[model samples]
Target chain A: MTNLQETKPLMHLLSATFDSLQSATPEQLEHNPFLQLRKQGLDALARTGLPTPRDEEWKYLNLAPYIRHPYQLPAGKESLSHLPQILPITTIPVVFFNGLFQPHLLSPVHGVTVTSLAQLLDRGSHDGTALGEQEHSIGQLLSPEDDPFVALNAALLHQGALLHITQNPSQPIYLASITQSDQPLFVNLRFAIRLSTGTAATIILDLRTLSKTAPTFHNIVSEIWLETESALTLIFLQNDTAQNYGVLTTRIAQTARSRSRLYTITAGNGMVRNTTSVQLNEPEAETVLYGLSVLRDTEVADHHTAVEHLAPNCQSSELYKSIVADQATNIFNGKIFVHPEAQQTNAYQSNHNILLSDDAQVYTKPQLEIFADDVRCTHGATVGQLPQEAVFYLRTRGLPETVADVLLLHAFAAEVYEQLPLEPLRAWIDQQLSHRLFDIVDLAADRKLVDLQFATS
Target chain B: MHNAKQPLLTIENLHVAVDDKQILKGVDLTIYPGEIHAIMGPNGSGKSTLAAVLAGREDYTILQGRVFFDGKDLLEMSPEERAAAGLFLAFQYPVEIPGVSMLTFLRTALNEIRKSNGEEPIDTRTFLQRVREAAQLLELGNDFLQRAVNVGFSGGEKKRNEILQMAVLRPKLAILDETDSGLDIDALKIVANAVNSLFGTIQSYLIITHYQRLLNYIEPDYVHVMYDGKIVRSGDKTLALELEAKGYDWLRSETLSSIELPSTTT
Candidate 1:
């Protein structure tokens, strides 16, 4: 094939993508001034184009499976009344369908307000400041090489939610975003949460795919900006179905003496990708990321996170544990970067995985890039099955094989349970996990390390 | 084939080693019903090796030996299998399994032993009742049942817990390997008391220790002095007192020359 033939097909796809970004019109953005910055952001997204297998980030997790199932946007007003009750955990619900928000599906808190990204853009940029993703970097799919999914998310800029936490105390605000999508579609949402000094609250982003077989593509970007002396606790539970393909890009920027703690418990069946990056932009800042996942069958769960200490006196601890069964696969990439100026920093990360089947695979990489002389950094990764000695001990005690297996599994997950502060929510998640999981009681006898499995209330 | 008529245990020349280091050269011993045999030895005398060899720790290999109990071979069994075969070894260092409650471990071990004995399974009510009785006799608080096995326990508490396990399992042959090492005077007495209360004419015991302090509470019918890889002397409980008074030097003084005399000539 000549160069003309190869370039010809790419030319048509490029033209189509360029036309899509033309959705950036004054009328579409409405009465917004951030449109100027938004246009520049979209132009950058268009320039990056769609990533292919050549891109390392998307190497292990290909977007081709999602791209093959092209989807049409939702038409007319959908029946989201039934969806309100679906988010049974809290009163404040932030609802989205195919990446589009349905203001009708939410019951707003008295002091809280709910609006779409289009409305916010129409209102213009924050105080007319020109902060247009200055570094202009889209992380890679598997590598941080700038994934095409991120560009696709940026292309559909108006379909996200503008979740403003603001500076408040009263009662802790509960922000929930539920996605109820139809058909195989690509839904992109950008969450902007700005917490002022001394502001505190809880936020939850719950992804719900309304169908099972027809695939769904959900590429979301969350920007969490923290102020000095402020604290934010975000719990993300991605419980979408097996056929859904989704990736979440969470970018956190914390201030001096500010602390941000994030707990992500990913369950359910799917090809799920999660990217969480925490930037220690100021001194005396603390960031913690705790995650637990249980993937079975042929499902795949990939987590890529980086905790960057750009300032001195910052600290971070990241622990991620996964239990894979059958042919399920999990990949964990946790990196800790300490800049030369960031002295007296303490950063630690550990990724542990338990494989139930011999064929089940786990790829864990823990990287530490330290340039500072006075910083303390340690990172370790381990992937294997339950300890045979621990297993034999439980089995000898007369626990059935299935019961022993369950107990061993529960023990593997107990490390993350230590970080969850909410009892009810933790209990609910633990209960649901035990229920949906395989019958582990029959694994064998003499497996003694399982009392945690019976900790279910 | 093991009915009520069978002897509790049978042993042949049991040679065991840990990490290829032979600890027991050729140990020959046996115990029938209604007997207590105390094997007293100095440090590095391999008394504990016999206990561990019988417990079926895979870390030690029996190069040449046959251990039969209740008409079945004990050497050809897993650690838990030996326990179910009515053979128990109170470890010198009881393993601490975090998150596993003492009550759960004991009940499971006891029921497995019972099941092997052909008795009906004990229900939860009976299990709780038995645990309460055993815990009280062992001086263990009700809270101990809720805590993880051997975790956060004092030296005395750990010994008492081991005896508490022996009381619960009611094994045919209960081997105590330095079970008195970490116990204080009071804890040692409590553990000994639990041992005395749990023992009966139908069961037997083989207690291994360095000092004569544990002998003050659990009186033994026979005391054997273990030197090098063999039992050099055998007597009644009075042998333990003579050793405490004369010291292990008395046996070492005589045995060292006889073995050393041959080595000098060689």
Candidate 2:
């Protein structure tokens, strides 16, 4: 165990804000169901302090660069009219600015309930109905004591969305979380999503910054609950700027015969870390985890995932690919845990990466811990450069060397991009990847030669 | 069709080495315009090395020699530049590119050649029409255009693909490097037919092969036997059939005795 005393100054810098939040007025803190949870989270943080590189989980990533400056909370919301909309607006959009939900940008839909935590808290007491259900679902699966960032998010939690789907809707829902600030600030956000039994829905969560040069720190925590025989698909797009830092922790709990899929796309930010944990608590549950990370220009991206099988006859599949270039670094840690009682568990994990530059670095660990005798588990990881023969073959076809390289890289990333369920989103992601990876502006014009159509169920 | 006027390709005592081990030791050959020349040799006789050096593969080092294509220095150009300058090598073992479609690859190559010749790129409609016509002439289906370049293709299919590319690119000097090695008899005839369909007075061919069967279909105008990294015999097409009848060991012993007789006489 590493001692936290060596980073006393850094710990003090974070604790000062916690102390001020503790001194809020009684009216501001009274009747808040999260108040006790916040206290517990702060106490847990004080016990563990900040994690150092000596810790096994933080061995490859150093947090010293992020914690060097003292970051204060944003006081109020800024203007939102000038921000550019990156995705299609056909679906219902729930906007969050600086961790606070903005009601004006929301589109109301039937059989769906969208509200903020602050609104629910302001309405005071209610019958044991939707409000009670929101309280029961939020913060139920994630334990703040296990992670310091989750604890910090719980302690300084501002506002987030509470989404509930009672019936299957005709269209998907889009959650847009935007952070904008004139000065350096720290923002904490929390979200809870509950799907009723036999319901199906697709949710797209877009996390981005309004400006490319804003120095912001975003700590986000989300808890998702799926009832029996329910199905859900969650797509998370983490696209920030070079001047921002973010950490996102998501916990998903699935019931018997439920199905879920989580797709995470990380392409921006100076330093970003994502931790996604899934619990198969009932029999015959299925989950698929897919992620793609494109890092360039000295940026760093890390993804840590764990899927635990606690019951019998459950299956899980995980696939993640990373493209690192220009001195950038990418880290991936994926684990599949099968308990003694969880027999007949079929789990597979694969992590493949392409390092484009000589200075690019990648660290990948795919682990399977199976205590059950009858279970089948497999995991593999590969890191390599572009195939030399393939490059020479394209050059023989008269494509310039640079053009050949760009085409090969795009093909490498298309393996993961093809897994997107929606056609429009897939095309959008394909265009964005081409621009960011190779500076190709009109990739759509070349679509006739490279595009492949797959049926979506 | 042979015009005994000026040589189209001239290799002047070409000496080549791969990994510092000499492969082609002082070899010379000449081909006239509109003439199909065949070079027959045993394994490891540097037949492939000659093709690779002409294609500018960069793995082989030229110790001392010069190759002139038409009137320009051929060794000074890059592989693509050589292609643009009307030189092509049909690989014995064609490479497999997993995600690049055949249509995309051929279009890019044709446009690149046109650009180098100071011409505009071919429009999509005309390009597709030409590609379909060429593919049909080689007995390939439309799906072959959408498939990745030679990926999952059978040996015969890959050979036909090489010929299809030859028809599309229309190079002046096409060097077929043992392209009939893994092909069956039917595929051999189809490939030969494709080659003969494109043959004209403006083009020439250098066919490198180990068997006389390929020559039965294409019928080279001249045949040369290569031994010990150098040409030891030169004649017309009958030389291939005679060598096929007696095998290469007889020719090897004859060359050895001729050299020894010269040394003893001196």
Candidate 3:
């Protein structure tokens, strides 16, 4: 990190990207407030450079190849046929392909307003709605100084969706970011969600790739603002192929009596990092984070989360489980901070992992900082294989070892998805889990399991 | 309903060890179809070890001996294969498997056994009917089938669940190892009645216990006394009453004097 030789490749890439951005579009610069933010982000990127393994947060993942790869903007035209099959669980869909918003695919909902950040900035006045009202809340919450990738995302941010929810939508909004390209490309995406007072909404952010050719590097950042008495249930689904790398960052700011339930599910291969940070700025706010990673082959899924209790009577709980097979790797780093004024706060964090093979790897760390004397905080982590006694018990009932292993692993992961509000989505996940566990999809087994779950519930 | 000449299970000179410590030493026994044989012994006399070894528990190492089930090499099969071959061992302590409903477990197991027998998987209707009948016979509520396998089940409920599984599976030889250990009088009678109801000429039972309290509810044709890793003496149902009155201490002394005698032929 100290030597100039170590930073040369990243520096070269950064300089090239900065020059390209400076010359790419001179016409859209007059009324764009984000242009200044992008310039500042580029300058910051030039100064700070890229992060190496020496950084504590990036210790488990090596980004040398991802950072040094020569990538360009996607040039190939995409079509509707390229869209991967999404389960028909949500009524509304907001689609983004290769970092560009597709207005034609968006379905209008009654209680929600979806507009691009660029359009709002074109109006050039604070209309007391969307990003114009908050005045660059995107850059404020997703500060470029937070991480080198965040700085890169800000430097390259162009088309971002600004969604404002004013009431309980009848159906969940499926915000899908799909990537498919013939050549190596960089896909940068940003989004902001603002929930009005007393409103409740569920949002699903589905990030997937349809291309299996050149690697697609996705850098996505999302900021959320929850007003008083508002609730948000957000599901972040990462289902990219192995030929992709991504960094997904989500930051949430909650007001008084607001609640947030965030779920991060990784069911596909590739290298991805998901970072979520929630801040309770007012009293009586609560946040719960649930994560499950089912990976195999050469896939790598890394998750880092932070929950900060800045006010009294705020509560936070986090549970993350992983089933890693083959030589795949999984990492979890969670931090809970209870400030001095955050008295009577209750925080809990736990991470559990099951390695399907000896080659599978898992690294988990739970960090808690409680300054308040009256706070209750607990954190723990465990990494193990399938319980042998349970396996033998199942085997005694005439199930083969492979079936026993699959059943136990499925049960281990069921805790995360069982609480899903939508039954169809839960059933879809059950089918997906069966496909991930066995080479051939066992539809009968999946059907039986679906019946069991429904009948028992 | 009895096949006296053709033996269903034969264990000859069986010796089993766990972690190189011999648990079963030169044990010999045989049971015919349509027979109910009980093994009454002291706490550490290798009663459960025999049952576990018969059910293909891999922890135990067989230093010497052979076991035959229906004239096949029982020791050579995996636990699942043994189960498919109609050998079931009601565990001394049934392990709890959370998140797998009893209905799913039973159906999957029955389907696997059926597959091994070159038969199609049981239909849903038949499976549910059999499960309901077995649950009712064991006095287990329908809610029990919806619960995770043995999860949060009491000791008595776990034993009853084991009987329910035996009833649904209908194994040729069902080894109940200390199933009566943690049951009250009422649950004991329910479980015994379930076992008795399932008994037939083709299905045999090997009940292992430390006391003779359960023998009153379910009569056994023959009773064997196991001591210090060997079947020291075996007799009829009257022997259970004799052991209940005189206790295992009297047999210990008598066994000491008869140690050099050749093992029983019958």
Candidate lDDT scores, in order, read 0.69, 0.78, 0.82
TM-score of chain B of 2: 0.95
Q: Which sections of candidate 3 miss by over 4 Å?
A: A1-32, A75-84, A118-132, A440-457, B1-5, B260-265
Scored by lDDT, the top model is: 3
Give candidate 3's error at residue A248 in angstroms. 0.5
lDDT at residue A12 of model 2 (Cα atoms): 35
Clashes of each: 33, 0, 0
Those runs of model 2 whose alpha carbons end farther than 4 Å from true positions after fitting are A1-32, A122-136, A439-457, B1-7, B259-266
* TM-score, candidate 2, first chain: 0.88
For all predictions, the C-alpha RMSD in Å is 6.6, 4.6, 3.4
What would the per-residue lDDT of candidate 1 be over residues B1-266, giving only the tens digit for each residue? 22445566766766777788888876666666777889998999989878877776667878887888878888887776777777777778766666567765676566656655677667778878888888998888898888877779877787788777777777778899899998888888888887887788228898999999999999998788887777777778898999999998888888966652211000
Tens digit of per-residue lDDT, candidate 2, span B1-266:
34556777988888999998999977788887888899999999889999889987878899988998987898998777788888888888888876667887788778777877878788878988989988988899999998888999998899899888888888888999998989888888888888888898229999999999999999988898888778878788998999999999988889888862211000
**Model 3: per-residue lDDT, tens digit, A97-168?**
876677777667888988875455545442324454754367778788888778877777665788889878
Docking class of 2: acceptable
> Best candidate, TM-score-wise?
3
The predicted structure with the larger TM-score, 1 or 2, is 2
* Chain B TM-score for all candidates, comma-separated: 0.90, 0.95, 0.96
Worst 10 residues of 2 chain B by lDDT: B257-266
Q: Give the 10-residue window scoring lowest on summed lDDT in candidate 1 chain A.
A: A136-145
DockQ of 1: 0.19
Q: Is the docking of candidate 3 incorrect, acceptable, medium or high quality?
A: medium
